[model samples]
Target: MKASYSEFVELGGQRYHVRRWGNPQAPTLFMLHGWMDISATFQFVVDALAREWNIIAPDWPGFGLSAWSPGGYSLLQYTTDLDRLLDHYSPHAAVPIVAHSMGANISNIYISARPQRVSHFVNIEGYAPVPEFFEGSLGQVVGRWLDHIAKPGQGRPYADYARLCERLQQSNKRLPPERAKFLASQLGVMGDDGLVHIAADPLTRFFAPISLHREQLIELWRGMSLPVLCIRGGRSFISKAFEHRQEDLQERIAALPQGREALLEDGTHNLHHEHPEQVAQLIEALLEQ
Candidate 1:
């Protein structure tokens, strides 16, 4: 039987757009997506898995259908908000979590900090500077300015829905063409200023780059004490500056507690969207472990 999409409780006054599957009363599986990505990215994969496990996927607070937090949002904000989300929706019952990119980072911290609360952990392309960037005041100010400058050009504003979809497809080449266009429709609103984007407040791009204190988070990952499955999109843009140094990411992964790594053969950084069936297959294996 197919499940339906619905909105659940709002967080910090922001509405959380969520989609569910299977029996709400059944054992659950939680899916969290990457930055600028909506829960719909998991639609195909979750649809295939939902019959047996209740599945819940929500847009991150500042992105997707969820209302953006006032004055933009940050990593810490997402972490705190997600804690509330899990608490209200699945409190007292540990559920398996599958997350990609930013979702992976936050899930690692949350599950690690409170190990018993999570039944399993699946991190897809979630490696942050495994050792983390330095965090003195200089790093903060410099990082902030560099973040904005890195984009170089003001991002294009979609003149229409079709244009928006094209831009999205360009952002992540891994998405199936038709599906990419479909998702683009939900990501913006028609406005006099062109298709004023609806997802991720414009200023959100300025949020501080997180510098995880490795010693702290490594200890946290250890506490989570659960089997972790790490999947990397074979074509992940892990090395933005030097494509040749893609393997450099390993030093960081080696720093991870310990686990076998899997590669999604036909994927980019957003591997889940590119190869949902493979991601689902990998998760099934992790669940069994």
Candidate 2:
């Protein structure tokens, strides 16, 4: 694994943990992990990169080592955090971003709102529109949110890191034993009860009260003129989301002025973890382009 360090900074009054790797003089790349993931999730990808790069990935508030928000997480809060993070790290120049899943969704919204702050985007399996079934009326959504919050969920605990590593492997069969071990160490924190719990806050499991405005989101995507490389894992459930709606998926890709798609036939949703070398290659290719 490449050498890395952690830095703590305050954003929106919350203490955020940022994981940084490579040389400070190298070209910078801001990495964003998916939901329930941490900054260290990008370690494999960082290790596979052929060239030098300064990689900055943060554990979003309420995840990993970052401070939890008593008010819960929201898309607006994430975008605001990204805005503040950009100001702190790259105040004068736009930088490339490589994001996965929820992180990619957040980047899509942020780049659309502040296009000048992002030079390029590498979106990995995160552009799928919200399924129709997930949509609900305002009152219904709020009621569900209220019900969920009334009895907040908690992350399950494991007896030890070995047990946690086994669970990780079960989730991703392609994950190597060594990699799984490393991830278990970073993703599971020891609790006062002497059990290992997921580093993310349990509040993250609750549903948000707001409904997604798909057309409005598409319009936001349309406004982004920067180069975007949308990657998908052929064997992933995310790809299954568009199995019968390829045209709708293509339409979303078409929304971007400079968007294009790439498929890794044997990869899964966690493509960065499963195929880090290929993922790094694709990112570097886009950067060089």
Candidate 3:
């Protein structure tokens, strides 16, 4: 795969590894993966969609093969960088945006706030405001205190590459052994401690003090006029405390100015990876709209 891939490109002094698949004349679809995930997350879907749209996927800094920023990395920085990439590449406009998890959040902000730069959007299992999701339940809060007393950020890392593979397989119960193996391989790196540490930066695993306000995201949605296809996993949280009800969201989505939605029958937070066939169908439908 790397043999067929283009070399990493440097932009703004940081290297970003990007890969494009499919026809040059076709419409472009920019894929964004969730936090801690690499561009490999879209390998299967990108291959399938490549025959139609030019699919471009880049590894977010600090997560995949891309170079991380000097200090802590933040989503705001990603949005600014994304805007530059869009200005440079999608200047002609009408670029379709497809994203999952944190990627979904970034794309949502970009398209909603700057519709002139984007054509359409497909968000899968995007995060929404929860009064308690970030705050935590009283019981969970107590549990956290207990956890802190026991050990602070001391969970054991993977024992070995094989163990890492096993852990990924177990967590992603929907994945086949081969698929899990492929994903696990991308995230494993030799660490100084002689272990295959997961590619995720530990600093990013915890919540940062700064983030866009929930109300602000809602405002973006309200002002958004571009076509939107918001798909949520039926099993996913509408809030950290509530699951999205598909039958209910159908009407709610229809009521939104220019939005439509579907609930994936077999999907998780990583809906695109977990249910690529359904997600691809949604993307095709959105493109037609």
**Judged by TM-score, which candidate is best?**
2
- What tens-digit string does per-residue lDDT give for candidate 2 at 1-289? 8999999999668799999999988999999998888999899999989999989999888899999887877777799999999899999999999999888988888998899999999999886455554557778777877876777777689999999999999999999999999999999999999999999888887637563466876798789899999999999887777788788777888888988999999999999889999999999999997
What's the TM for model 3?
0.83
Of 2 and 3, which scores higher on TM-score?
2
| lDDT tens digits, residue span 71-99, model 3 | 55666778877776676567777688888
RMSD of each: 4.0, 1.5, 4.4
lDDT of 1 at 79: 78
Ranking by lDDT: 2, 1, 3
Clashing pairs in 3: none
257 Cα displacement, candidate 1 (Å): 5.4
Highest lDDT model number: 2
Tens digit per residue, CA lDDT, model 1, 120-185: 888898876443233457666667657664553334577778877787788876677877766777
User: How well does candidate 2 match the true structure in TM-score terms?
Assistant: 0.95
TM-score of each: 0.83, 0.95, 0.83
Count of clashes, each model: 0, 0, 0
**Stretch of 10 with least lDDT, candidate 2:** 127-136
Off by over 4 Å in 3: 1-4, 136-156, 244-255
Q: List lDDT for all candidates, in order.
A: 0.71, 0.88, 0.69
